[model samples]
Target chain A: MAKEKSSTKPESPAESSGHGGGGKSGGEVNVFDHLELLSAMGRDFASSLDIEASLKRAIEHITNYVNAEGGALFMLDDEGETLRCHASVGPVEIIGLTLEADQGIVGRCVQSNASEFIRDVSKDKAFHGGVDEETGFTTRSILCAPMSVKDERIGAIELINKRGGDGLFADSDLHLLEAMSASAAMAIINARMAEALVEQERLARELELAAEIQRSLLPEPGGEDYPVVGVNHPARTVSGDFYDFFPLDDGRICFNLGDVSGKGMNAALLMAKTASLYRCLGKTVRTPGRLMARVNTEICETATRGMFVTLAGGIYDPKTGIIRLANAGHEPPLFHRPDGEFQDFPAEAPPVGITPILADGDEFPEIELHLDGGTLYIFTDGVTEGYLEDGSELEVEGFKTLIRDNAAQDTATRLDAVISLIKRGDTALRDDLTLLAIDDAKGHAARQAGESPEPVSVDIEAAAVEEELLLSLTVPSRADRLKTIRNAVTEAAKLCGLGKDPAHDVVLAVDEACQNIIRHAYGGSPNGKIKLKICRTEGELIILLRDFAETIDVSKVKPRELDDVKPGGLGTHFIREVMDETYFLDPPVDGGNLLRMIKRL
Target chain B: MNHEIKEDGGAVIVALEGDVDLQSSPDARKVLLECVGRKMPVLVDLSGVGYIDSSGVASLVESLQSARKTGSNLILVAVSEGARRVLELARLDKVFTICDTVEDGIAQVRP
Candidate 1:
């Protein structure tokens, strides 16, 4: 009962004045009535923080205080171009309606930022009859006032047809409405500001989660003996640029870098898709051009609107010192010769996802370079377009100069020099940055010589054979164990009277095969073990690798098109390229795979 | 890895030091992702870094993807030797914008 009275107390002023009868009384009594009304209205305004509910209560009070037949509160939209009727009373449902800010008396009050009183609405040129047409309400006189906070006009409130016999709205009525409108305007602004802050906080949390998922898709760095590296710096939480590298069975490294157009989640998703496609297809396809074509077609089929990928990739054969490259609308890669000359291999084909299919004959064109002992630098445009503090771009020429200056340095130092030159000023990057450096085998040897010596422990077990078993050993599926495994295999091959070239090929093939088992079959699990057995027959050398890991579908294990131009799946391609014959056996009942390869001596 | 974030204009500049490897990449990832969530341009300073492994590179890549989603930019400033080598070997130097200093990174973002 107390709650009900407290709520109704604010309405007592309107009931006591007999609906606009306050104007009939003299000045002192009218002033006293208004004072009571102002206090009551202030209590109602403080009752709720919700703008719509509080505005509705305020309008109801205004209509009763002024003895109006109808009243409406309009609010300005964000653009401040139009007024929307937010709350209404005593007439048709005009709530949720819109009007031009300059349309009627309410608009006039808003424009002038002052209260208005009309003795006869029919005589006023500013009176608009659209509401009457819609609501079937006749207006005799009207009172309107602008709603503002801190001198900024937000909207206005209007009351129509004073209810007394005179049917006229007085100046006092306009003044009361003006006071209430000011308070309402401040409440509305406060509510909206609060909502915006909450929304900002929600969005920030979602983006962080998205970034975590994207991070897991990238491969680990610094495992390859090929002296390769890649960096992707996003302007946001996730990046649309990606790069990947994997060793082929033939001691070569297949690597690729790509950029998806636009930024954010969509681009990141597309980038992951494109990278995976390249990796899956690159395994089957040995030719860089053919591999890129297949990846381009796949991207075109799946990419969303306004999305595409620019890719530059290649296969670097460490033995022959040859690099086969394919570019798809990506920046030209720089080839730095040992003699200090730079060669640019620019794009010859369009970016992927732009067309349904690449041009038939010239699809991603391939470029081949024989680097004796030089270094091949493949990169995206981030390097060439890096900005300095002066706002000048590090153009291709500047990139070349940096490369030339650092050409004599080791691969790591050379790459560091180039990046440092681009990062010489205090500025943020405008795009993702990526670079790949492939040095000749001699360079690999040079880098390796600086590394600390590893402890050598050989445990070779011999199985009965006609003459002798070359070598047999078992090691854990770990990257560090690879060197010891390779050395033992080479020594065994040498004892079998194999020439240096054949011995080298045997060593490479065995190393690549073990790498595949460790990386793919064992999934890099340190606990997984691989057994290597090499035996020389009367006319052939046979090698077998056995692993206890999940079995792969041998039938599905084929290299993608050579033009796929991505990384991964190249282990099989390498195995096929280096060995005379290779076979992947079905898993044994206990769950393990055996890979066998043969080379005619 | 250790990092500090500062606001410059409408962007956030993160200064990173120490080796960013498998062991420390998670920490780097957290700081970078937080900066990206602000939906403003980000600049990572790697001058104080001595080494960065694949996981470190992956963290930065993830940040780039997040920035793109939020319509912000992520840039690298003052790349160090180890970070540069890993980035170059993976061919990411061409994909990310490298700047010489934080001021340059801020200028690029604002411009």
Candidate 2:
């Protein structure tokens, strides 16, 4: 169409070239008119937000220049099975017309990426007359050009019935349409790319806001001392699994864990809804089964697209050592006996959001269990389905072994150890992991009567971030006050990479030294005061003990012989056995003694 | 310190709780001596002991000697972590008759 290429300056078609001075040749368009058409298409196809409207205008201008009665721009659907008219200008409104990609003239052009010129439509086998028969438009000649770039076939453009010429499309008309279709194809692809970028940014922002709402809906983490402990590690920025526990007025704790079906924003939104329903309805509805029914009723009315939530809920009384629980299609919660026995309770009803009411009369089935110095473990399938260190799935048995391995530790440590086991550093988590442990508080209390306080769980991440910590305390040298000193020392030792046996040994050594201050320093008098200062710097613990009593003979302090089989001097032996260095320091005041101890981490 | 004295299978079981140091070891010694006076068998459960000092160990040693004089068995059941370490420091673990559980302690005493 353009023998004269695009120039630096804009020029009128007649002045831009003189090729058409001989006035039009047989069945070909005027060179000046063709130049005008090409220039117009170039200017019109750029910078358009409404792609369909712009294409409609471009097709209208092309039909006029080609002197055709009508033209339609057909585009292939996503699946490429059919062609639909995206833009059309004709005597009949075939704008939204559709045809199978293998059945019509336009379809053939799109499939083959070639242009077609039908001089007479009556004899053309590729032409379908369905639109003509339905719209009462007369059959005539047709021109179809493939709208493609390289090998990609976007669609095809069709024009019919040349308007004042011999009522047929010519070679020049095919050339003009093919050139324009290529430009249109490129414009459509660019416009689609721009649209997709915009849509992606919008969805990202929406997902971020929804994730924030989900985090806000979550509850605070339970500490080691709390009998009920829960932990969650999300596979993605948002999770479909959630758990919560809160104390009730009647000295009982209510807890629940749930997993919503599906993934992405839809699943996350449903999870938030189900979690809120339980937190609100779990308070007044004492019976776990009745609470589940109310939650199910609310979910059934609102949850769409066949989404559902599997959940388990229970109320535990610390005084009575009993729990009343209800399960709804969740993984069976495991009850581990103190005797190393495991019993599983399976779900008896379907998950919520399937129906409004339960099939078994009114509520989900509930179980009453007594925790006799044992613990109940509730977790999602993510833990079992997680990959182990050897790359095999941590089936139910593997997960139970993780629990049993750390069962000798307290409840919080058991959960941490299990989480650290299945946690992967080289690959993303296959699913979200959520677990909860309900301890038998009353049973343990009856056995642990005047025992010292339990140690709190260490925050390993925080310990890594902080390299130094100082613990200072001053208390009377009394036997009852020794436990407080032991707890503080244990935490410091754990932070310095000394835990389990090594940490216990450090605590015992300190306890023995403090006992000497009460017995020997004060000479069995309760009137003396004691001070302790512990500091960890660069992975080394330095302990200082200050006593306000008569100074002892340092050289004479010794452990009794093993053959003696006595007890009073074992304190001195324990201190020498555990600490890397132990010596007496000069007292800061005149009337006291300072003992220095150091343990290399 | 607090303790519970129960007779199971002809063995006097004395379960001690809390820290047994200089201040509380005297009470533990009195209880152990009373159980030994029964002269059948004595099982001291150290499972509930949090922090037992040298004086507490001395009380156990005195009770064991008294128990031997009467020809009655003196056993330790469920010894706690802290108590076990203290016993091992002076090779007392080799000297004492220790069992893993109360059932084992009762079995050994009866047999």
Candidate 3:
């Protein structure tokens, strides 16, 4: 290949028209014709957005200007392993011909990143006659040029059999073809970049839409005293984990946990449909087996691409501590009893969307469990497979240990601990972790009666949840500052619908409690801090006061007798007089004491 | 907490206002004890009090004890419903002399 030094631009087009027509063949056209052809190639390539059309016009102009009988333009496929002819002008139909990227005269042009000029194909060792043999077309001469844009090789263009005058190609032909291939290469690269940008935009919109759908599908948080708590953390844009629980008129709570087996839009849409199906059918279906069967049939009828959901649905009766549960290809739910024994209920049937019908009619196999004051945990594999703080997978054993360790916390608080355990760091979860816990409220009540540490498990578990703690304030244990607590308590009592007199009673009760914390818990040290939290759960209001002090033996702290009330000891008496229930709760954090008071609304 | 003290009809009238909690109860105790220590008839006006805790009740009880030792009549006047409830909870209602208004307390204490 010649060094590109000679100017293809003619001194004057009118003056050089004498040799303008390249039909003169191998005698070679004047610089005027080369100038016109080069400009025309640039124009044609730039004018059309359709890359194939531009390349076709470019190759035809190049072949005709060099006065060859046939020509073909080949492009490297996306993987760049093979060169396929995209446009061609020839005696034989060669538009779809394919060749290894490193074969024949054209392949050498691409590999060499330069032009090839062969006077006799049979004399050139790199020339391969496979095309001539297949098409019966004789090729005596060849001119090929590599097409490249900014160091990226597009492919090569090949011209065969010079048609005029000595029938041999010269250096001028190779130079002209090389200049025009650059324009063609530019067009192809630009088209690829534009296509990539469009695909990126399309995916971004789909992810955003899926996120909004997931947000709308999740239900309101379960109340504090309610036996259910759920937490969901997305791996990224959207995840397939979902759970929902709602109360029925008969005092039974219906709940379900599911992991849809896909990602992105498909997973998000299926989650919405399946969760709604369980919630809608769960209200009236009554039996867990029948509900799962109906939802399974519906999912199978509409779901595509072998997508499925591993689900466990149940109706919990708090009154009798009973749970009727059905598991469909989900991870086995762990039931942790108060005495520390765990029972696991694994999947009993195929996943929700895989089979349209059950072997035994339309009902799945169901198990009636007496939770008997134990807690039931249902979670997606994301939790067990998720990376923990130390970057190790939590797995099932680790998850069981986590539950046992935080077993004393309220259900919502324990679920939060599970979420943070797998959250790892500030980074989004590696996989979407969805966890739900069903703590038997009866168990909590029974444990509270026994003065056990069970009711002491504490958590503000606000894991992306609604603000359940209406008031949380930390103030110094100074006696004068108790007024602020009183005012806040009065407002909290009013917000929860306590009448004027009753509200004041609660206010004074909280005030007296703070005073006691200042006096007894802090040893009258004003430097100590007290954290007060007020929350309303179901039909009761709960006030929890936390103090960092020496732990007190709650059994020894007694309210003074009303008949024998003296000036200084009336604080505990006032707390017991107004609040329906009062207990010095066990603090989950070390060295701090927690006192809980409840007033039935 | 805010307070007003004056002599009215041969009685040391001590009126207290605002929520009398643990923080402000000392101030309340100061004003009440100063009046009861005079060994004169003391009429305690509590209508301005909105909320009172046990500490505030303790201050009042201490002042009442001082009044008894000094042989002075200590009468609680216009006790707010909330304060009355606290007093009743401590069974202090049976112990302190409570009247409907300052005039009633003054009439009862002077008669």
Candidate 4:
């Protein structure tokens, strides 16, 4: 592009059109005619809020009225730092283009907050030649005006190259352009604000839908004939914490509680996946350790970076008064024994989905407890981390004391008491709160009647005294010999007229107990001997397994935390789940331990 | 537990029987990993398997990871109800390439 110099100064229309000189070739229009056109343009600008279409019309009117070659309208971007070509009707298409806020004639008009009318192309220092160079559109004279609403400058409009008469813009053209820009600026601002509101409403509706889907995934509280109760309270509309329990076909309940890292939609989505996975895998896996490992593998494959799930879950056999639990990097559950003693089984492994915790070398410990007449309280960190009005936390000790205070209440009532204690005072929960309570209903009932707290003992003694010896066998404490022991136990169960389900359970229990003896009691030595005795009565089947190995430390033999999600340590869990009553008695004076397990028919 | 391995074209097919629990998963993993090590397509037919525990699932996961590393395809065929439920519970039903029968599984690998 070439720059040319022009030194003629623009005059006002009053100075140029004075004396009423008539043109010979064409009809002359007066100042009153321009006023009518400005009035009509103002009316048009006020009629519609479609900023793009209205601005296009306004630019068209300005260029046509002034008889210019073309015109373009620039608008301030969201950040208000640059000018963008929002609408243009010119020789070249520069729409969607951008320029610095203080770069050209248009920028000068915005900066000075005034209109510019030039008769020369190069003489004015404010004139920029970059647009002519880019679009190859030569310019001799131009009119530029700033567009603004209130005191805030929005952008500028520039009409290039006057087309008629002397081919130079006068002060009248700047006057008309300024009037049109004022209305256009207001229309653009109003339209943009409306669009933003619509977008916000759309997003709010979507979040509501997500919350509904999450609510449907939560299970109802309580189970029939089993004193199991659970509750979940989310800090936000959507929660990362979840708990679930459902009856399995074999007269047992499988339950789980998990807390996904983080909160809101991302955590909620993972919580749904983890909870459903537990429900599905918990049914067939039988062993909590194995079930958790399977879930960890799947979550590890799908979870995003820096995301994981801390979980505790188990299967409770109401008929056997036994519970097998597994923990994965979650807060240990509080186990309340009948003797008013409480124990916390802390995590045995890292949380799932963080790393490979279930591979060949990893270990997932399982805890097997005979509930006989006690309660197991499983919860998320939300409970222990709850804050009081003074900003002090109710740590694990405080939570344990809370449970101890409510120990005499039923399972549902105890859960409520704990929840109230955590939510007491003027403190708000910082995380999703979830709790699950499993109670031995028969034991609770016997305790309520002020009888001996050993409800399980009474039942076992009644059966043992009236029972008949079905079969008895002795075998070496070897992994290889477990199959023979299982076979013998199965035959004895069948002879007692037990159904396929119960018989299978009896065989599995005996096999697992024998395997534990071979591996744990005898340290995997094959030379040690084991004795098996089977008896059946009117309402129960009892089995006694004796091992001549060193006396087992009962406290040390407590089930390992299932959270480890490893490949082993599930034998004790299987034994407890399969049998109704299990007792690891102190070794006799002769140097042997007797494990007596009774399963009610 | 018992497993039978066969070959068809460039793919290896293995059919498993009995419960795939902690006690049996190691053996299943050995056989499955060997098939995957062939660096070709492998298909596991679990129609005869009655039960599968977490360890069994872990073995399958290992095979899957190995198959991805070797650029070989691993598919499950004729998954029994027990296995299918557990796989769905773990959400692996969506991750694994599963077919209703061995014939369909073979077609998937070949095609």
Q: Please list all clashing residue pairs in model 3, or write none if there are none.
A: A408-A457, A409-A457
TM-score of each: 0.57, 0.51, 0.50, 0.58
Q: List the residue pairs that clash in candidate 4.
A: A320-A580, A326-A562, A327-A562, A327-A563, A328-A563, A364-A566, A367-A559
What does the lDDT read for residue A94 in candidate 1?
87
| Complex DockQ per candidate | 0.01, 0.16, 0.25, 0.10
lDDT of 4 by residue, A1-601 (tens): 0000001212323224321111112224445545545565566666665667777877876676566788999877777778889888768778887888887788888888888777787888877788788878788887888888778888989888877577777666677678777767776766676789889888778878877887778777555546688888787778899888888755578888899999988999999899889888776676677778889988888889999999998888675567888888899898888788888889887888888745434446788888867888898888888775578787888877877887777677777887786676545678878888888866446545655323233122333566698877888776556657767887898898888767766776677677667656776677999888888877888887787888874433432222222334345555666678887543455666778899998
User: Candidate 3's residue-wise lDDT over A179-293, tens digit each?
Assistant: 7777678778888888899999999888888787787777788665768888888887887889989887556788999999977677878998999989898775777888898
- DockQ of candidate 1, scored on C-alphas against the true complex (2 decimals): 0.01
Model 1 docking category: incorrect
How big is the positional error of residue A574 in model 3, measured in Å on the Cα after superposition? 56
Per-residue alpha-carbon lDDT of model 2 for A278-309, expressed as tens digits?
A: 99988767778888988999999988968999
lDDT of each structure?
A: 0.74, 0.80, 0.80, 0.75
Window of ten residues with lowest summed lDDT in model 2 chain A: A455-464
What are the per-residue Cα lDDT tens digits for candidate 1 across A1-601?
Answer: 2124324665543345564675456577567666666666566655566668878877887787677888999888888889899999986778988889877888888888888888888889998888788767787787888888877778999888888667777777777787777777777777777778889888778878877766666556765544676655665777888888777654567889888888888888898898889888877676778888888778777778789988898887664567888888888888877677888888888888898656656357888888877887777677778775578888888878877776667676777776766655545567766677777846445445643222221222322245346777888887657767868987988877888656665665676687666656765578998888888788878887888787753423332222221224434444566689997543444667777788877
